[model samples]
Target: MNLYLLRHTQPDVAPGICYGQTDLGLAASFDAELQRIRAGLAEVHVDHVHSSPLQRCQRLAAALAAGKVHQDPRLMELDFGEWELQLWETIPRGLVEVWTEDYVQHAPPGGESFFDLQQRAISFFDEVSANNEDLLVVTHAGVIRALLAHALNMQLLDAFRLRVDYGSLSQLELQDGRVTVSAVNRRF
Candidate 1:
């Protein structure tokens, strides 16, 4: 089975502001970016399209899939809660301390931890693999990181090592329960 992972286009959010599952919209310039993405994937025939429930991903997925978008909550970005719209530097000191010191175990107030995200992503991947079909997933950077970690068998806490830029594409192939990463962070 082939998996094509696509991170959403640039969001209409302020710089340095955290926005996870915040239902943000894409920038107006994203129309061109979406066109580029479509052109890049023009050759690979897509079988199914999935997206996070967030509006940012859903909107793009709908357009790309031509209204064939399927909602997958597991693909949602890690919840930021109180830090959802705060600048990184201005975040409460306790939140920063927890995030910097023990991100793996620390969930933001009313939000999810990296560990939590990893579990959800793994579950989602298992289901997708069982289906064994070509799939295009329009999701967030954190979800992309979790997928990378799952494919590579890296520690969940180390998901941050993967850097997925906006509108980037990653590919993975799964066969007989084995996963091989074909590409990562490719933008066209």
Candidate 2:
């Protein structure tokens, strides 16, 4: 099985806002982003398409798959809870410090921890790996990072160090019960 993980296009959010799981819209230049993504994926043939329910991801998935997109909450961005839509710098400095110290186990006031996101990513992987098909998943950067951690058996903290740019594509190949990463964050 081949997995194509594409982070959602640029979102229509303020420069420093935390909009994860906030259901934001696409940026004004989404069409150009779409064209770039399409050209980047032109040689790949996808048999299954999945997307996060967030409109930012959905818009790109719908555009790429021509309405043949399946929306799933498991693919949604990290649940930032109270931090959603808040300016990054405005978040309580101490609380941010606590989270940054060990984000894998720490949760925001009402949000989930990185562990929760990993569980969701694993669930999606388990379900998809059962089928023999090429898949294109339109999801968030955190979700992509989670999947990369799962595939590469990397520590959560190390996965956080990976750069998942908007509209970037990552590829993984699963064969004979083994998984190998072909790309990390390839932008068009």
Name the weakest run of 10 consecutive residues (lDDT summed) in model 1: 95-104
lDDT of every model, 2 decimals: 0.88, 0.91
Q: TM-score for every candidate vs. truth?
A: 0.95, 0.97
Residue 26 of model 2 has an lDDT of 82
Tens digits of per-residue lDDT for model 2, 1-188: 99999999888887999877898888899999999999999999989799999999988998899547988999998888999899999999999999988889998889999989999988998899899789999999999999999888999988888999999999999999999999999999
**Highest lDDT model number:** 2
lDDT of 1 by residue, 118-139 (tens): 7898898889889889999999
> Local error of candidate 2 at 84, Å?
0.9
Candidate 2 is scored at a TM of: 0.97
